[model samples]
Target chain A: MLLSGDPPRGRILSAMLATIVAVLAVAPFLFPSTRALAVAERIAILIVLTASYDMLLGYTGIVSFAHTMFFGMGAYGVAIALTRFGAGWGQVVIGALAGMLLAIVVAAIVGLLSLRVRAIFFAMITLAVASFAQILASTMRDWTGGEDGLTFEVPKTLTSAFRLGGGYNGNLVTYYLIFTVAAVLFLFLLRVVNSPMGRVLQAIRENEFRAEALGLRTLWYRTLAGAIAAAAASLAGSLLALQLRYTGPDATLSFSLMVDILLIVVIGGMGTLYGAIVGATIMTMAQYYLQPAMGGLANAFSGVPLMQAVLDPDRWLLWLGLLFIAIVYFFPTGIVGRLRTP
Target chain B: MSEVLLELRGVETRVGRYQILHGVDFAARRGRVTMLLGRNGAGKTTTLRTIMGLWRAGAGSITFAGRRIEALGTPEIARLGIAYVPETMGIFSQLTVRENLLLATGRDGLASDRLDRLFALFPALRERYSVPAGVLSGGQKQMLAIGRAIIEPRSLLVVDEPTKGLAPHVIEVLIEVFRRLKQSETTILLVEQNFRMAVSVGDDVAVMDDGRIVHAGSMADLAADEALQHRLLGLSLAVHQ
Candidate 1:
């Protein structure tokens, strides 16, 4: 922030970054192939989830363990809005925004309750709140569809309305629309991160008392940051529903989801925006491909083939837990931290 | 010869479970340096802090520039032309010299000139504007602190201790800077324990002992009074170490 000697150039760099994203987004439809469309849709989903996590964990210093509550709420909000009302994508977007707004309101009240409590107490409150959210979701089974979850006819016309080589591209149009919104959001967040408001946040992280002494209404500013973080997670909820055509506490929001986000931000570097993307990519790759790939190596080492069976998808949790320990111990600064130091 | 700028009437302060200042009555004149001289534990620092509203003033009031400002916050007190250089310097360590200056925003319209004047006063700051302030030497950091605050709308600059552990040359430069600051229409409240250095720059001096103003008079009177110095500071010229 200091060496740049100019603040306006950040916006320009963000614009350039956005242009690259736009170009990468178009490359999937070079042939309109089904194989390419599936990959694109997956990336779109990941972007929304990761971006929301970044806004909360990176920008704000809350380091929450209950953010997925808002994400789940947003999904349910949209699902209910669409299922009962037969509303279009506009209502879903509004529903998501409403979820975000609701999260903001919740965060404000929660922040007040937790303001005086530093570190451990704050983290504990969030954890309890998230568990409560999941329980509440199941209790409202009449509206939320209980444990079985809710399903709806995917709003085909909204996606098809766009001229992505005209009619019925199935998931391709939906992926493109979500991808575009995510891209815009990414740019918008970048603008916010480099603004005057962002600098004050950084200042707060370095020394909150000093920032408070400077006549900054520290409580209000912190609560506002929390609200913004919740809003981002809520948007992620909306995108999750649209992509999967389903909404449930299990899928849209859960304790594990918040844990995954914590892992992502820790891997990415807590304060940087790009760290979220990096962390998500690292985590997703580990889950999607690493475990199976390790099976061949395990066979060579053990010759018993027990490694693959024992280290299947479920055991990844143990590995993730150990990875977190390693992160806190050996790489306390996270991935981006060491690079930014010099 | 300057007009009165600060009047502390029966000011009292309590920090934590202890009352650190008691009925400390003193006044600083505009465009002149007033030193708060005392031994290490004689509440020299607490007096400066109470003036800036760092600690709550339990009783009495402080009138700065003809306004009662005892109840104001630190930033509010600072905004009213009273720049404080805390004993710790309060230098934003992560920020560069330029960024520290940027954060010390004066009145909305008069900030630009103050920035320019500060750069002109300290040429080294201009050279190392982009470097983080944490990297600067003790003297340079002190200079930056003084430079950052000694600008527009600042009539009183409260310096806790500029030469606490500085070498002789650095101490000389700080004194020169303080002398220069005094000439530029800025009243200064200097708190120091080194009697020689304290008495030289300050036009008026107040000696504090255990939370009370034990003596208050012209700098010349306190500097020349050897009997009082020996009684208060346990220093005798004949048995000087």
Candidate 2:
């Protein structure tokens, strides 16, 4: 039982978590770099997305490839509202709510369609649905802006690089906003997983037939988890659109983005909530800094053709592939899970 | 004897293309331990599954508390006050024993008095209450599974092979536990391969073979007649005794 797990260890974990949050809050002042803040914001948004995904894959034991579909819905929700409705901050809230509702409906439909099948078939169904959604986004040029995507202005206060008085200005406000949202969403997810309902989710994950024998309506619980996860993912999607002031299929709905989420979950530890945040930080930092750093190494090894090719910035995926291999080989339980084991 | 708590009349079940239960008729009277005994592939498990609505009955009917439940889902059947301990001992291995028991109960969770009673019956579970069930020994895991079933009071309890692969001492403990539970008000339908334990615990007996009940009678009748046991079970009860 979560209530009975090592109390001292739990205390240490909470302390560690508090330290991490404090450091993140003061990071902007400590670094004072725009590029750093941008990277941190990106990680913040992804933390919400991946944590939501964990609710399905980790807690509920449902491997879904259509997570990006909900994320895209959130982004497009805000994008469409601003571009066509000439929406303000109030409309932003309306867009998020609409996106969440849409996500619940779509997730329920998809879950009903695919839940009849087993794991691999469910994954395939979600993939097919995600691809179809991507195509729909591309073809519906009228609403989605098609392949070119949509760029729109947010409220002047949010977009202004520098405001004179107490109004928010520059990267600091956006970064803090992103951080606050991510933190709140992460805590919400944590609360859900710790609750008695969450315990049922884990029980279903471990053995659905058994859970049912205990009188749990497993399908309904799993469906509820899907709706909750989808809603949170859409929230992240909306934040991403706000952060970039742009929306596109490739950016939001791509299967590659889902794969990135999978990588973050696996590398950080699939079921652990905070692992998502830790993973987002590690992976985003790698993406931002790995290529250029590897480029410098590539030049150093230019004399050796093979070494230079392997170290090339364009081939940074090779290094990432190796990193993935190393993580799986050494830490199969995941970083956070491994920390908890001892 | 009390009225029939569960009655399966002419029940037939098909899993995919193959039919597993063929018009099987069975009943568990109130406050009695009805043992369904058979060799492997005898459809004993299927009969229990049909009663639980894990497999839909293609024909005939299963009546629980005077209501037809042949068309209900597994959860619906479970909600009708039946607790099942599957053959695999269906403990959530990743969860702690206490969590497994907690999930068995809903919002209020296990009452302290009820928990203390269960702990007294199986003290090993109390010691390993916080440990993940996967780490618990096999006997302890079996205890946890049975503990989960009794976490909430139910009208009927169904168990499949509760003592399978257990040590003699552990089996002895379980046999006593079942005896004590039989003293309680709940009706029990048990599927078991070990005839010794069956003879000890069961009040009524049904011998199944190839998806049908070949013989049904009082456990006293079955136990007293070694010739009948030899003819049906391919081993005399005297030999094991």
Candidate 3:
């Protein structure tokens, strides 16, 4: 067979994935906390975004810095449609399509512009593009709500945080919606990576010139990967806008948001699809919980001045930076890569 | 054997302001091994790359199977049934040997009969089909690279420095394989520094220097005339052996 013949291992991994999905589907009822449900939904959205980044960085061997711009497009698309046109399901769908279309067009343009440049130069160009996008978002306040962002009313049926029936609450409904969309997109990407085409992407990642010599249209494939990734990241941004009911330049188009994605991919290990999910969940949860937990512990041990300084939630990023360095030092392959290593 | 399969007519190529190939004329005859021998920095590799369309020809033309391919992209040139194995062997170290071969064949993949033939040619590859190509020994990696290139039928096979860093036994094995390949319809254009190995398999030979072809003739003629070889290559083929 052309494939390496790892059917048994594939089967076991799929089974494990099914079980994880099953648990996540019922997690709202099991956890019974609105905040917990919120965090889980956020994780789901971030997972989709992070996984999309992996398509470029991991599979296609491209490093892009404009990922969050597309994500911001998604958020803006949904928010602008909801607030200006009204909350009809049809309008939301159109807005999502608009956002995704923008992402694809931008990605294609960027792909074309950077095609002839070296890898590091391409990254710099994307960084410049992302900066330009953020500036545009902030300045074009008429449509995007500028610095304050757009906040719109949702359809009451979806805002059911208090509705009671069939174990479905507003939080649960929102969670399930985000979770389902994320799951479908994630699975689609998984299938894409496992196919024959995925093999070509991986080949390009390993050696672009060799792949080219072997008769592969490396540029077309790289462009395709970038477009797909941008679309998915946009969708994730739309979900984030819905979840927060806010679409601001800071939340969507900021450099920090892009760095967050980079960190998630790096921590999860690039190339492995599941690593994106694992890394998103771990990073999101750490940001959500670790800072406060450390802050509380530091307060309890206030006698030690250094403990308070290092453990302050305001200084949480410093701790995360140190953690990132440690991960790079000890687990260079990342969490999934390290775990898989013999 | 006299029929020209791939022809380069006054092809010029530049890489970042440096002209690597200076108006070169080269050809590979059908069903024959054409050895391209050159010293370091003689633009032998550049000649192969220009044919493959990896480096765009600044001027002139390349014709494969009677169609101009100099202006085409790399994939289009490859799709015209020309396979290239570079000096690096170009094996994807992370992928298993099977995957590498599959990628070479594109969507159709290797057929049973073709795979069987490949296994016969390189038995070590069959033994480690599922192992990552990175772990293969240097000789085995060369075999894998050649196997990937010949996984499907092609009009011409261009190989650069195939015997570089290879041991004597490995070179002998490659020579035998090439000899068998030459008997088939495929035209072979090989670039090599090893005079002995090149002379063993080559039917037609071309010697290159200073970004241009200095000499072209039958391999037997070049092998027999030590004085001519000494004048052209600075060393005779017999001396290297």
TM-score per candidate for chain A alone: 0.80, 0.91, 0.90
Question: Against the true structure, what is model 1's DockQ?
Answer: 0.30
Worst 10 residues of 1 chain B by lDDT: B102-111
Query: Which order, best to worst by lDDT?
Result: 2, 3, 1
List of clashing residue pairs for candidate 1: none
Docking class of 3: medium
Which whole-number lDDT from 0 to 100 does residue A333 have in model 3? 81
Clashing residue pairs for model 2: none
Worst 10 residues of 3 chain B by lDDT: B178-187
DockQ score for candidate 3: 0.77
Candidate 1 lDDT, A246-339, residue by residue in tens:
8988886777677777777777667666555456656765666565555556656575567656655556667766766876677576665544
Q: Tell me how each candidate scores on DockQ against the true complex.
A: 0.30, 0.80, 0.77
Error of model 2, residue B136, in angstroms: 1.1
Q: Write the per-residue lDDT of candidate 2 for residues A53-161, one digit (tens) a residue.
A: 9888998999999999999999999999889887488878888788889999999888877776898999999999999999999999999999989999886656655
lDDT of each: 0.71, 0.87, 0.86
- Candidate with best lDDT: 2
What does the lDDT come to for candidate 2?
A: 0.87
Collision pairs in model 3 = A160-A170, A161-A170
